[model samples]
Every structure is written in structure tokens, then in C-alpha cells.
Target: MERLNKPLTTRQERFCQSFVIYGSGAVAARAAGYKARSSNRQGWRLLQSVRVRERIREIQASLADHRGRANDVIIGKLEMVYHRAMENYQYHAAARAAQMQAKLFQGIEETRAELAAAGIGRDDEDRDRETPNNSPELAGPKMMTFDDNSREIDKACTQMSTWKKRV
Candidate 1:
């Protein structure tokens, strides 16, 4: 329901923060103290509220901006380290710093290229996607979590072990 500039209640505020953290509506609702059984329903209802939606968007936008700023800060510090290492005749440290800088820039460039290929304008998308931590930027080995039949695998393994022992 849309209301005229309604301020979010404390629980609503907590829900926004938790939603951002977990990226799950039901989980966020539970974290915000909603009844466990009704958390999913409450989360859906909260998302329907215009005010709540706006707050979530605002929170996400701020985090995106902060992430971008953080990357810039990191690059700047790396540059300083590179210069200092070179001045101190620490060739190894200087080379390491240069390598890190190259990797960081390469990641950023890859993300930009991906965005372009996907038809996302540099200025139009959220800044977070351009950072090195983002998958397109990281472009290397990644660990994936899969929810497979682990219990069944365990059972099968145990049965196989027992059969081998008997044989």
C-alpha cells in the first residue's frame, strides 16, 4: 500500500538492513524479528509497501557508491606503495605492487567490457558491478556452492564401504 511519505518503523528499518545483508526476503523478515512461520508472508507484504521499497533501493544505491569509492581508495594506496617501494630500492616489493595494480585494472576493464557487451552504459548501472570483487571483474577460479543430495551421497558411500569390507 502506498502512503504519503510514511516513515519506516524500527522493525521496517531492521528489515531493510537484513534484506540487504541476506539478499533474501524471508530471511530478512525473520532477522528483523518477524514470526518465523510468517516471515515469508510478512516479507512479501513489506516489499509491497512503496516506502519500504524506496528504502531498500536507497540502501542498495548507497552501498554501491561506497563500494566504488572503496575500490578507488585501494588503488590509490597501491600506487603509493609502488612509489615508496621503488624509492627504497625494494625491487621485489615494487614489482609486486605493480603486478597488483595491473590485476586490479585488468579486472575493472573486464567488467566494463562485459557491461558494454551486455548493453549497460557505464553511467547507467550501479557502481558495484564495476569493482574487482564482482564476478565479471574477478574472472578467475571461483568457488560455487551447490545444494545437491549430500545425504544420499553419504548413505551411498557408507554402503559401499561396508560392502568392500565384507568382500
Candidate 2:
């Protein structure tokens, strides 16, 4: 039921309710008994009413509140699922979370390696002797050659520079 303080005709109230349900003003107008050919115009006119807009806002707020409650219910169910998974020794979900965590930390490792290569070694005694790309052990699993990687890095840096200048 509409809770608008402002006066509205029954048809106008129907228009608001139908609009909320269908998300199409023309369809709502038609449902509210306007002729199909003129539904769009009538819908636009009804939308101009302060009372109608207020009623629509009330409907939308109610729908949002319902959705919020529904989400809470869903989260509660998910928590139960998580507990059940843990009890059943289902490691897949835990493993997936760990994989995501590892991916997030991948950047940190790359930055640390880069910093070590820049003469700021992880240990103070170990001096930065050569570029990371030069060290076979330090070079990543891809085994990318120094020249190819260097060219790619240069190209990317150039493109970034061009983009920065444009921005």
C-alpha cells in the first residue's frame, strides 16, 4: 500500500505501483488503464507529480530494505556453508582463498626483487651485482630472455609516457 501524505487519484497510485514493478513508465500507464498509444505521454505526466515521485521513492526504499534483509539471510546461509565445509574437511574453498592471497602478494615479491636489484639488497652485506634479468636463478619461471623482456618493458614504458602526456 502507498504511504504518501500527498493526495493522489487511485489511477495515479496504481501508476506508481505498476511503475515500480515493471520499471517501464509506458507499461505502468497502460496497466493503470491509459490507452496504449498515449501511455508514454501519460506516464511522463504522472511522473511529473510530486506525490507520485514521493510514492515511487517510498516503494524503492521498501524494495531496497527487503533486498538488504534478503542479503542478510544469504550471508547467514553462507556462514553455515562455511562452517559445514570446515567440518567436512573441504579444503578447496580454503585453497582458493590462499591462491588469491598468493596472487595479491605476487606484486610485493616483484617489488622486493626489483628493490634488491637496485642496489638496496635484502641483506646489507649482499651488494647488488647484476640486474634481475641477468641472474638465471632470479629470472622468473618463464625463462624470458633479457633482450625480449627489456624491449617489452621499454615499449610499455613508452606507451605509458605517451598516455600520461595525453592525459
lDDT of each structure?
Answer: 0.69, 0.61
- In candidate 2, list every pair of residues with a backbone clash: none
**Model 1: per-residue lDDT, tens digit, 1-167?**
46748789999999999887666789999999999999999999988888888899999778656645455545655666666665675555655666676688678779879989999886734444444675554532221111232333344445545663444
Model 2, 21-97: lDDT tens digits are: 76788999999999999999999988977789888998877865653434333333343443444455554442333
Candidate 1's displacement at residue 116, Å, is 20
Q: Estimate each model's TM-score.
A: 0.45, 0.38
Candidate 1 regions with alpha-carbon error over 4 angstroms: 69-106, 109-167
- Top candidate, metric lDDT: 1
Can you tell me which runs of candidate 2 are displaced by over 4 Å?
Answer: 1-5, 69-167
- The per-residue C-alpha lDDT of model 2 at residue 26 equals 95
Model 2 error, position 51 (Å):
1.0
